[model samples]
Target: MQRSIVRLAIGAAVFTLFALHSAGQLRWRLLDRIETFTYDARMRLPAQAQSQAPIVIVDLDEKSLAAEGQWPWPRDLLADLVDRLFDDYNIRVLGLDMTFPEPDGQSPSRLLSRLSDSAVGRLPGFAAASAAVSAQIDHDRRFAEALSDRAVVMGFVFKQSVKSDEAPEQGVLGPPLFAVEDAVDYVAPHGFTGNLQGLQAPSGLGGFFENPLVDDDGVYRRVPLVQAYQGRVYPSLALSVTRAALGGAPVSLLFDPPAKRRSLNLEAVELGPLEIPVDEQVAAWVPYRGGYRSFPYVSATDVLRRSVEPGVLRDAIVLLGTTAPGLLDLRVTPVARAFPGVEIHANLIAGMLEGQIRKKPSYYLGLEVVELALIALLIGLLFPRLSPLAGAGLAAGVALAVVGGALLAWQLGAILPMGVPVVFTLFLFLAQQLFGYFVESRGKREISRLFGQYVPPQLVEEMAARPQVVSMEGDIRDMTVLFSDVRDFTSISERLDARSLSDMMNQFLTPQTRCIQQYRGTIDKYMGDAIMAFWGAPLPDESHALNAVRAALDMVAAVQALNPQFEARGWPAIRIGIGIGSGDMRVGNMGSEFRVAYTVMGDPVNLASRLEGLTKVYGVPIIISEITREALPSDWAMRELDCVRVKGKERPVTIFEPLGPKEELSSSVRESLARHRGALQAYRGARWNQAEAAWLELARREPERRLYGLYLDRVRQLRVTPPPVDWDGVFVFKTK
Candidate 1:
């Protein structure tokens, strides 16, 4: 028991270590990928039902390229496209999905400037040539004019760690959205690539399209709502477009209730009336509805040519990007392998509008730790006491509860850790069950060692398989009980010396015990030459009654076979009477605590012993109660002897002598069984004349059978003094 407790302690310690590691109290790299994958699955769960958001995408797809030639279409064409979006289609806000880091070199104004700077520039007419050329074609200036005084946000990319010798900073940037006085400490990028000055000067704002928080597995599950670069925080494209749509309302960090003993952990970012929940990293989990094409996509050529349906982009927040394979904008995500990167931003914008962005704040980690401990503790204690099948059920129930809780939190726009707690619960349950098995096996071995010599080997092996079977608790089951005693053993014992008598009993008991054990019987105890045994215990036998009867027949045959050997040694040949009864009995380790044995006790067992005594009076080797005969198959041949109330019982039970198989009996034996049944029926019916005639004939044919003679004499006496009319036809036995 002390060793078992020690093993349980070790299991608990191992579970605690894993729980602490999962809670981030210990450093382990093996768990990082698992946690990340768990987060990915959580993000892909179905979001709360929401209306179709006012967000749309203007895709530069293959159709657009076929209609409008290759990309880098002249700057005037891009200017014209921008003009069409705001001036013609009347979009509320337009966000570009691509970047413009360098100026348009193919513009006519650039060509004219390059030609004028060459040797032709020294000519006097070159000034006239330059003025005429620059006046006609300045596409960059024209594109800049198109962006002014409009709700337009351009895209840029950031670098976390820069190694390039070239300048990492370019283009113009506006003031940070969160003021310096606000004192927000967010993650900052090392370098950035912004638009050319000409375009930057006219745009309303710029947003970084590149994600700085992609997970180690390269899946974009969370997008930063806001990021910091060079001590100033900037908004992402999704946030920039949303702010523009809301009429340029300023975005602020929310930390109404700060974390314990630390600076405030960012909880959410608020834009006017719209609040977007965010984690400590100022990122929101992407609420993916499905794969790509979640938002409505309009071809760029259709939009430019005004071929799109009217009012499609009227009040929609439009993102201009390409889906063509050549554009290289595809991304790997949880729901889809080849998800368009532009659709990611569109999803975020829509989520912000509907308040569907789920977040995992700093407090969730503490909740995760608490949940892990509770789940592990529950299954660890539960699994040791239950069967293997029940243990597996408990583990499955814990997993479902954990997963359901996580999903419920997601529905409420909160994130909680799921995988660690679930995995920990199952692992702890399995460990505890395995440890319990090891402990239980040792207990079974102890039982086998103690009971090996007392009971049949079959019973000992059964006890080894299930240690619970050997406990002191008693159980009620239908079982067969057997009792056997050598007839007149006292006379034989007086004739021999003590040593000779001991040798004779040993030789007599060994073969009989062997026959009993070989037929799956459990030896209960031995009283001198009398042996008590039973079946249907420790391991249940549905055919217990049949097996007990067969073992009794085998025991009688075995004793007969040993008679010659006994005579050769000058010892009297043994004759035994066996009694068997079947009924519900209590079987287990039963007795006072001072002295207990695994044995059976009940009325059926007492009756079996009583019937053993009757076998000597009736001159039959075997006597079985009616219940035992009923439990056997129909082919077993048995002759009903009498219905008699025993010494201690009010109810009268019919007893029978078991013969060999019905088909194996001789024709004369079969005719005798029929006539005996008829005579018993007539005797019970009080037809004294017919009963006397049947019994006389049976006695005359089989004069050696004493049972028929005993009944025949009773008929003659009962006829002289007739029984009362109300007699129930039950004979009473005064001796056991």
Candidate 2:
């Protein structure tokens, strides 16, 4: 038990370090899958991508709306359209994208409200107006009575991230037919499942936002067949449409996660249908229509208002929806932007009906695991026994094999999660190569005794796995650079003696440095009491700027707690200036020929120092350049500081002073900034009086600050003695 525990602990520690080191880059977040990621419809693609559906779309176009009596044209008009299709045309099935959620305006209040624009969002007012419509249902009873038993499917949508809090009327269809489901299938640490909103569809089929799962790039690709929603797994619109078109016979879906597959076991003896287009793990490929014109479209008002000339609706399946300006039911498909939502359903129904549904086999993970294990075993267990070049060849061969195999499988209708496995195998291969180097060097030279004792155990394990990483050698990669300096370090250094200064420096640097390390930032080197670090490489971080900003914020908090120690020691409290920037540069061992030292050297590093310089100039503690600002998510609010070029860089980079941890800059500060920037622009344009007036407004709002003060000094000079006529908004720099 002890041996097993120790081995497990060692392995865990090793994997943890591996993850941390590789985690140097931005980690793809799996949080809030529903909100963050929007899906594509790939589940319907396959053999039917080229198939055509004769279903015609009766669009309630803006032109039709303008021609017919505007939107919400009386139900009499809708009834007339339905009657034409049923009696005169005979479309196989009629789908209504518009709902009669409320009364047909038989009530005077509803009629008055409709003409008065007070019914802005009161569509499908069925919930509230059902009682009034009770009489109408009996009166107009003609259309309502016809729909009561008609093969007409109605359209509905959920409240998906509404932009406003305007409460919408609930659909009379009741709660979402879909229920929240348990994790009944494969587990890859990601993928979504919930009970379907409406499990029992009254229509032929129900569709979902099976938005194709295209990579970072948008493309119509793959989709899942059985999406576990609410509690029951609901088929995609295409699947449901296909099943519905096929007369929806009972069939069994068998999922074998261990085998990495799903199958549709058809038992429909009536249709003698054993057409299991869905394969292992109940996934399929979606085929797309040739284009938008592939499906015939007839405006809704045309179908309802009888504008369609005869022969258009004969033997056609009619799907109805709006193309009115107010109805923004448009999606980015290989089709038109004015594409109707019903057409998407039509495509799915057509695909299913034609049995052109392609399946996306789900054994991708299992195959990836086996391949990774094989490669790992081959490299870790056998490749090390070969020469270096042979090992290199083997590793390269492994990578090529993995990539080629995945691509081939993709071509053959399979999409495996090969990213992690391929990465893990490559990591393992490189690790073994590095391990060989470490062992070889150990054999050649006397091993250093117990270096792991001083450093953290985690760091020791990290250093062991790939000792070359620990070597002075470094690689150039884009990383976040952080530079923080004590505001009055010069005065503090002078106040204390050599011992006292060293003590204060150690006292201050220890915790501040630890904070950076805690957030996975590398400590490049410390200058007196200042700390500098980067987030990429040695231990990569995709969110280096974010991480660096977090460390800076945390460092401030850490020093806040340590202020008592400074107060007790009769030393001045430390105020810090932090500047964070993200860019590409060389970060590694750099020293004289006599001795090499580990550090970073680049223009971005220099820019980081300049940004720190701006903190004092701007009277803000933490300043970040626009590059850093761009790297962050939109939620983080920051004020723009200056549009000045740093000393070394040619182009002007915007600088932003990040207000300390939610303590946002006051409105006064913001207004002052607007006036400041305006005055600066004016002053540079040689408009002295205009600049003075703007500066006056800014100064009255906020006290004299360095930036405004600098501009004021320039304005004073211009008022007294104006100089160059060719002046623009360029500030001349004299010092680096």
Candidate 3:
């Protein structure tokens, strides 16, 4: 009962911590980042419905720039382009994704005024001719005339701060949507860069293009639909364009009832029958249809020349912008890294028209709080009574449900807080499990103390969890056993003092032991300079032979690594050999009642010991029996050394030397291995001449390898002695 109480208490504490974070009483930057990351990922998913609203982008692209000269082209050209768009293409609404903060410097009137002030003004007819030309080519007036009474919304910018050297105000701002006092929540700009009075007066509609709610990570996932300037609320370019497109509908603010001691709570912005849900900051999530070029792009040059496909832009809402990098209108958006700023407005306008904008209302916070509370009840109150597996299942189910719910809400044009609830569920589950583990660890500790020395610490923990898997009585099972012994150990030990020899042996045995444990092999015993280990017992590993062979190879490498240190200490460089064999073996605690120890004993174990001794004869670091070779995967590289019957066994067994995994073998080594296989086949067939030739070639190419020389010697001797015709090719060992 006390244990359950402790578990529940831990769960409750963790729940409370995240619940506070969910309710905004506490802040966790990590959770906020996670939320933003998930939001981006969700946005990238295939949208349930693509925006089919008639929206088009009037892109001032590289082609347009090349054909029409550089950006900020003469106002007359813009005026002409505007006329073509309205007269030829019949665009419904046009919104500029650029700001015009100053009058055009290249206007014909300005040029003529400059000319008249020069010495040329003294010439006859100069003033009169200049006046007539100026009136005919006054580009700013012509551009303003093109915009008059049309559904054209000019773009502007909102500055967060005004520097002393910069103008505090520029051009002209359109009428405000509502006074700041009328709304409870808004993002107020310090200053703005509006369109020219001529342009603003002609259209009488302008919207700020600056995004005030770009995420802190510099990703434009959400943008405020409305902002405040000089105590008046203003709409963004997309909102303004949308309003104009809807027959210049009167936009109104929708507010929730004021809370105690709180002002009116802004919820949505309404224009005609369309309602756009917004968060507390009056921001709406960008409903990106896809990546770049989601909307049809009609190059400004093509539009100006009337070369666009007929009906492509007829009655279509167009956003005038540029994809040219030199124009500096690129933005980092959710769907694309270098997205055209104009497409953002197009997507927003389309979203507004189709009613596909996702809403994340202020009440989402309260909803998340409720979610956390339910999770707390499910985990804190119920997890303590369930088993660890059941608790884990519950936690996973809760996470899936939370994510599923969030996705469902998204599909329904809403966004529910997902990251915090999911994180809280995981934390509470882990806390409960950890508490349960500590409380139940006393029995595990006892199991460790009993068998810790014989098996790995991990195995002991497994045994503690499933005590029935391990037994004291001997049982016969198919397994793999490994034996490793240092070469010339007697001679090396004779040179070192007792203390020095002990330290050297300890240094040598530690890494070899670690190799065995890392490969999930159990140490059976350690004789003077030899180590015995086995796999496939206590915890049955199906890859017993493969793991044993891998451990043997690693043990040989470990000994080689220590040789340099030994030589530095004036000790002879050490060499070791390993042998592995697989077959049926008896494994369990064995000995007199007073001194019984966990170990394995059988024919395979004995054969492994003998193979270790034969490593000296073959001059190889590691060897394995035919059974062990058969168990390994084909990826392992092995060379058949010999077929021999030891003194006590009548049946001959094939022995092989491991050349490491095939992938690590050099090309030359692989070639040599192929030749060696042919040579072994010849020797086994009693083809003395062929065998001798193959062995001689191998010995010549690899003079340092003793195995080739040994085989070559055997072939020459057999040729000379001329064995009987009935003689089998098995070599017999008469001694251990």
Q: Which ten residues in a row have the lowest lDDT in candidate 3?
A: 257-266
Please list the residue runs of candidate 3 whose C-alpha ends up more than 4 Å from where it truly belongs after superposition: 258-264, 443-736
Question: How many clashes does each candidate structure show, in the order listed?
Answer: 0, 66, 0
Assess the local accuracy of residue 660 in candidate 3 as a C-alpha lDDT between 0 and 100: 71
For each candidate in the order shown, give its overall lDDT on alpha carbons: 0.82, 0.58, 0.86
Best by TM-score: 1
Candidate 1 matches the true fold with a TM-score of 0.66
lDDT of 2 by residue, 1-736 (tens): 3322432343344344434433434343431121112222222234224545557778788877877867777665666777777777776666665544455555344554454455543556644664555445432344554554445554433333334545443433312223423333411111222212221132334434434343344433344444443345544444443443345555444334324322333211111163434433344444456455467777665666566877877866676766565877665454333455566666655655565544444443345445655565566554534666887787778777766765565445444434554565556656655655665446323212233212233444444434544544667878888899898778887887898778887888888877777777777767777777777746456888887888888888888988899989987788898888888878666788998755677878888888887788778778887888888877676666657766667887878866533346566656665676677677767778898888776666656455566667777876787776765555545465
Compare candidates 1 and 2 on lDDT and give the better one.
1
Q: Sort by TM-score, best first: what order?
A: 1, 3, 2
Q: Which ranges of candidate 2 are over 4 A from the true structure?
A: 1-48, 53-55, 69-73, 87-89, 106-142, 146-149, 157-244, 247-294, 301-314, 322-325, 331-343, 356-364, 381-400, 403-413, 425-736
> Using lDDT as the measure, which candidate wins?
3
Comparing 2 and 3 on lDDT, the stronger one: 3
Q: Judge candidate 1 at residue 126 and give its lDDT.
A: 85
What are the TM-scores, per candidate, against the unseen true structure?
A: 0.66, 0.40, 0.60
- lDDT for predicted candidate 2 compared with the true structure: 0.58
